[model samples]
Each structure stands twice: as C-alpha cells, then as structure tokens.
Target: MPRYSDADLLEEIRRVADVADTDSAPSLQNFRDHSDIADTTVLRRFDSWNAAVVKAGFEPNDPQQRIPTEDLIAELQRLREAVGHAPTIDEMIEQGNHWPSTYKRRFGSWAEALDAAFDDINGEAVFESRAETEPDDPGTPGPHVSGETLLEDLRALADELGEPPRFKEMVEHGDHRARTHTKRYGSWAEALEAAGLDPDARSGGTQQVSTDQLLADLRRLRDELGRVPTATDVVEEGTHGIATYQRRFGSWSDAVEEAFEESDA
Candidate 1:
C-alpha cells in the first residue's frame, strides 16, 4: 500500500472532522495537511485523495446526507469519558446541520424523524407499517368506522326524540343518519337506532326527511298535527302555505301524497 505523507494524513483527519462536522466539503487546507499529495509534487494522485477521504468516512458533496448529530454527540461524550475531550459548541452545531448527500443521512423518512423527535425524546426508531391496499385503489381513507360527524347527527336526532334510541340498529337499518348515529353509539347500527331513533319509520321512508327537517316534523307531528287535519289536509287547505311549509320544513306526507296524485295520470 502507498503511504501518505504527514500533510496527507492531516488532510484526511480534517476531512473526517468535516464529515463528522456537517458534511461540508473538506477545505484545501484540509487536503494539504492530511494527504500524500504534496503541494510542490506532481499532481498524479489527486483522485486517489478523494477515494482516501471516502474511506475515511467523509462524503464529498451531498445536500441531504444528514450527519447523525445526536449520535455523534453521544459518541463525543463517550470519548470525553476516556480521552477527556469533546467537540465545542460550534463543532456540535456544525455536526448537526447541513449534511452532504453522498452518505446515507438518516435511517427513515421525514415522518419517522417527526415521530422520533416530537413524540419521545428517547424513542427508538420505528419503520412504518405497509398499507394493505395499493396506492391507486379506492380504499378506506383511514381506519374504517361510521364517521364521527354522522354519529353526532345521530346523537342530535336522539336528543330531538327526547331519549336515546338503539342507535346501532338504526345504523344497521341503513338510515342516512346511521353513520352519525354509529359514532355516538358503539359501532353498531342496531345499537344506535335502538338508542331510540324509531328506525322503522325514519329508515323506511315512512317519514321521508332530512335529519333537521325530520326533527322539526317529528315535533310538528307530535304537537300541531293533531290540532290541524292530516298534513295533507293542511296542505290542501292552503297552496301558498303548503309551499311555504315545503320550503321551510322539507318533505311532508301531505305534500308527498298530493304530488303523487297529480302525477298519477
């Protein structure tokens, strides 16, 4: 093996420090001191100096090659334990920031870094679990369950009913509100509907309605329908009033029946 001059060896140490620093390219002074290449000699083996630097664990010019600053600091501490020496503050900062790309920077992706940094100060590295489906497939957005928003609507419906129904049953019955219902109750539709949504009528289109309109209609049916005639009777009693009700209250039995009669031909 060809032996490097004293200056060449110094340059190698400088390159090592630079890599162990933040992967900034080793300076000309570093090369001058650390390698066999003499300033005055024929420059035949300049390329060899590069290879030597690589062997010394210094990457040349890679932007993303992050030095393991924390690990390096720990090692520096360990060195201090025996050799009574460690890098100064500037050196520590240099080691942590701005790395070269030629070397493998960190172990995992950005998400892994975030998980490790923000979650646990002493956390061990963890690889991400692979997704079961291919990326292009229309799979579930996240872990599957009835959406929480739908469940909240269900809860609101239950409150309108003045008692919780068996929400799970209602959900199982496939009411439009079932998703909302399922979130408040356990993941069961029957349980949610049973929470007291009267899924039989609500789910069946016996009372065709959106959630808020349904609540209002339920209240009207309980309170005002008895005072008036059937909803149909009330509708026929006033065209403008029925239109107004349809506009404000959504669908109703009377309006539905009248429309069906008009279209029956």
Candidate 2:
C-alpha cells in the first residue's frame, strides 16, 4: 500500500468528492475509482471513511438513506457486464454505485442479491448458479449447504489444518467453497465461532462470554491479541458489539484509547 500521509488522504477524499460533483462526500467506492490510494489505507488512518470525509471538509452520505432495490440490482447488472462474471462483495464495493451493506439489507446478503438480479423467468439463478461439473460437485454458490453441516465441516477442517481455516483454505479441501459458510452465517469469522475454532491458539480453546465493564473487557482483549482488537474481534470474542461501544464511547478508536488508559490508571 502507498504510504500517503494524513494530508494526502484528506486531499484524495476532497478530489473524489469533487469528482462526484455532490455536496456530500463520495462513498468509499467512488473514492477508489478516482484515486490510487486504497480505501483500507484511508480507513486505517481514521477509524472510518466517514471520519476521513469529515476531516476532509465534506459531509458523508447519510448511510440510512436506502437506495431503491431496483436501482441497486441495475447497478449489479452493470458491474456484472463490466467484470464479465458474477460480482463479488469486493467488486460491488469497488465498482457498483452502492455498497454491499445496502444490498444485504435489501435482499439479506450479497449472494441473494445476485439471485434477485440474475434469476431467470423460470426461477433458475443465472449469476451465482453452479453447473454440475460432477454428480457430487456442484459449483460455487452451490447447492444449499445446511448451517450445521457448514459448522461441522469447519470443525473437521480445523482438525486437519491445526488452526481455524480461512475461506481460501477451504477451496481445495472443503465439501464446498469456504465462503459457502458466509451464505449461511454471514462471514468466515462467524463460521469459526459456530464451529468453535479459535484463530489465535493462544486465545485458549474457547471464547470469553463475559459481560464485564466495557473498558476492562477491551483491555483484556488487547492483552489477549497483543495488539488493538478490531470491532469484529469484539463481536466474535467479546460480550458486546461495536455499535454498543460506539454508543458508550463515541467511536471505536476512542474506546480503544480509553480502555488502554484505564489500564494505565
């Protein structure tokens, strides 16, 4: 990743927002199209794209303003034509007019949204359907795999790999694509939880189910990870989600700092 300073990032945000020609800041996808700097790099400098936009002197778009479902599907179709394949979540975020979360709220998940847009008049899915390459092997977004089966397979894979299996690891060894779990459980991390596998073996063999003071718990997690624990880590391992932290402490970075300071105190 390019090591642009904070000023470079803010300037890029302004450039993207100006190209968007709107009063509100451009979405992350829009920023990506207009600049060489990555969205992740910008986000790491600030806790969020919205925070970066605010620092750049533009108002971020209202996240709650729902796009019409039809418009979202149309954008998906356009991206499909551009990429010449089924659009993945990354592709959607990078190229589509709207974000993946918008589609998730509309159709329950990104895969389901593809079905909505590409399903034939006869109810056969066109975009995400797997052709039966073999009697037993249906392709990706393959035949519906049950949640229990997904979790069980995750366990079996963890036993084989001696660690929590990433989505890519399951490609060659799993009954289906590791990402198939996301269709059932929303994400690979959740799949690991459902299967009871720990990413860091040092984290013990189990997740903490404590409801202690938020700062103390955050401190504990940072100690366990030996670094700042992301919001997803809290959701997967801690007792509360990031939304709860945001409500109590304003922002995730602020909460992390306060938690570390409390430890010093």
lDDT of 2 by residue, 100-165 (tens): 767777788766888888864222344334333322352333334456777787889788877776
* Candidate 1, 1-265: lDDT as tens digits: 2223445544545644665453455633344444322321212333333444454456654323333545533444443354332222212222322211111235343333333333332212221221233222221111223345345545665666554444333334333433332222322323344343333344243443453453344345435544433443332221122223444445345544444344344
Please list the residue runs of candidate 1 whose C-alpha ends up more than 4 Å from where it truly belongs after superposition: 1-247, 250-265
Question: TM-score winner among the candidates?
Answer: 2
Give the winner by lDDT.
2
What TM-scores do the predictions have?
Answer: 0.17, 0.39
Between which residue pairs do clashes occur in model 2? none
Go through the candidates in order and give the clash count of each.
Answer: 40, 0
